[model samples]
Target: MKEIDCRGLPYLKIIREIKKYFNSIGEGEAIVIVNSELGRSNVLRYAAHKGYQLDEENEENRFLIKIEKRGCLEVEDEGEIFSILITREKLGEGDDDLGKILMNEYFEVLNEYDKLPKEILFLNSAVKLFHKDSMAMEEIRLLYKKGVNLLINDTSLEHYNLTDQITFGEITSMYDMVVAMKRAKKLIRL
Candidate 1:
């Protein structure tokens, strides 16, 4: 298996699209861009929910997403993940107010899907998602119950004085974040 980077591009769609594209090309490897840690996680978590075999110790980073193997999509070969890395807080840069609104709608979309992303992560100001009584907090709770892996930055909790306030997900370091990204079958942002 080879890896292709679809960073800043539409990676998820590309994966599905490749299944069709490869009909002509036959066989090859591809990568999909998932620029955020949360995005990377969402994909992996979704894979797990579907009952795909994931390497337990590498669960956080390397996602064993089997497209052709699962009978979900018809492809010539299986796939492997090299890694995924996310550092930014939001999917895009713009007005914070607008970004929040957009992000909320985006989560709503994710929630509506029959398959949710592998995980949701909170970092920097994005931790505000888990802030006390935020409007989106209930949705976070629902997603968590639905088995979507959730995480928050340990440093963010300390810097924002949120240790006492955050009520969702476990705390993680950059090391954990890197592992999750590296493990995803695909990554998404926004």
Candidate 2:
């Protein structure tokens, strides 16, 4: 069994790395050592949600999680996981007003889905949507609350003078966003 040391890693990073490794190997057994309660909980939950077989050994302030990849959860479409990239304040390159309206409608529709994209990265003018009174704020907030990772580009937020206006999501660097996009099975741009 492959052994992974997850010390000093955030829970999300641990989960992402495990998922990536499982996808690459197809089937494998591995042991992960985690040192935080939040990390332990997230790791277990992720394993369960993806239908992997997991056994755990609890220690003082640490956990040894054994994961055996049986199979992945049943997805409607096989072999596809998605991430979303939104770089504009609006949806299309048409009339500005109509584009804004379309973007709002798009976010609302996304909320009705049973499964959301793995993450959503906002770049450029898209950061505006997280500011107060923004039309798409509520819908995006709902997605955030539903466990869809909402990330806003730090540079974009600063350039747009929206540094202090964020109402949801966490500020992220371009490097982090690029890594997530590259690691995702598919990336949908808006």
Candidate 3:
């Protein structure tokens, strides 16, 4: 069995390193140690997404995840994999305050849906929605907790000078955003 320690790493780096490790190994078992709940959740999601068998053990301040890469298990199709694209701070053109209210309500309603989008891509002014003080922060965080990939545009973050104010989501490039759009079964643009 191989062991990979991922303590003190960001969630994205943890996922990336684990992915690289799995790709390099053959049929074998590996143990991943993570110290944060977000890291643990991301690892579990990655394992499940790849159809790898996994078992988890909780320790005093960390989680020990045992992953076995025997073969990919058949994953049943759950239906259309859609993505939501937000290009503005608000939902529609109108009074800024009303638009803010509408956007907040929209995310709140989306949270009630049985099947949420596979990912939510934030672009342009929509990147502001990820700021720690944004009104929609709660809903966005909940969406992430529910396994919806929150992808924020890096350029937009820099444009708005909000790169450090963001509290959730992965900072991604325009190329990644285009790839996600192309791969989505359906896209809901806002």
Candidate 4:
């Protein structure tokens, strides 16, 4: 088994490193990853999302996760691979003020979907919705708790000066976004 010492590493960096490691290994091969307490849940979620069968344990002050690369995507119950990309603050091209209201309503309507989108990605101006003061906070939080992946572009957060104000989702890079979109069976851009 390959061993990865990820203590003190940020959760996203650990996720990226683990993914790189998985890409280099063959199916059925296993890796042992050690993470700090703060990163344990994120690591577990990432491993599961990537279709790795995992066995984990607490050792002293850290978590040891053994992950086997399955070489396949985890099959969702509905078997649909869909992602939503939001590049703007609103749902359509129209009045700026009204668009904000519409966007909030749109999130509320998202709950009606029988099968929620696998990922909800926010970029550019859309990333503002991830800030603590967002009107769509309630709906977005609900979606997150319901197992939908929420991703916010790091560049966008920086541009909006909201990198520190965000209260939800994983802050992601362009590379991550591109990779995720490529793997998505269906992608909706709004």
Each model's Cα RMSD? 14.5, 13.8, 11.6, 13.7
Candidate 4 to truth, TM: 0.58
lDDT of 2 by residue, 1-190 (tens): 8888886797557866786678789788899899998888888877776778889999997899999987556435654679999999899887999999999988876875546898999999999898787898999999999999988999999998998998668899999999989998889999
Candidate number of the best lDDT: 3
Q: What is the lDDT of candidate 3?
A: 0.87
lDDT of 2: 0.85
Pairs of colliding residues, candidate 3: none
lDDT of each: 0.55, 0.85, 0.87, 0.81
Q: Arrange candidates by lDDT, highest first: which order?
A: 3, 2, 4, 1
* Higher-scoring candidate on TM-score, 1 or 3: 3
Off by over 4 Å in 3: 1-78
For candidate 2, the TM-score is 0.59
Candidate 1: lDDT over CA atoms?
0.55
Candidate 1, poorest ten consecutive residues by summed lDDT: 67-76
TM-scores, in order shown? 0.52, 0.59, 0.59, 0.58
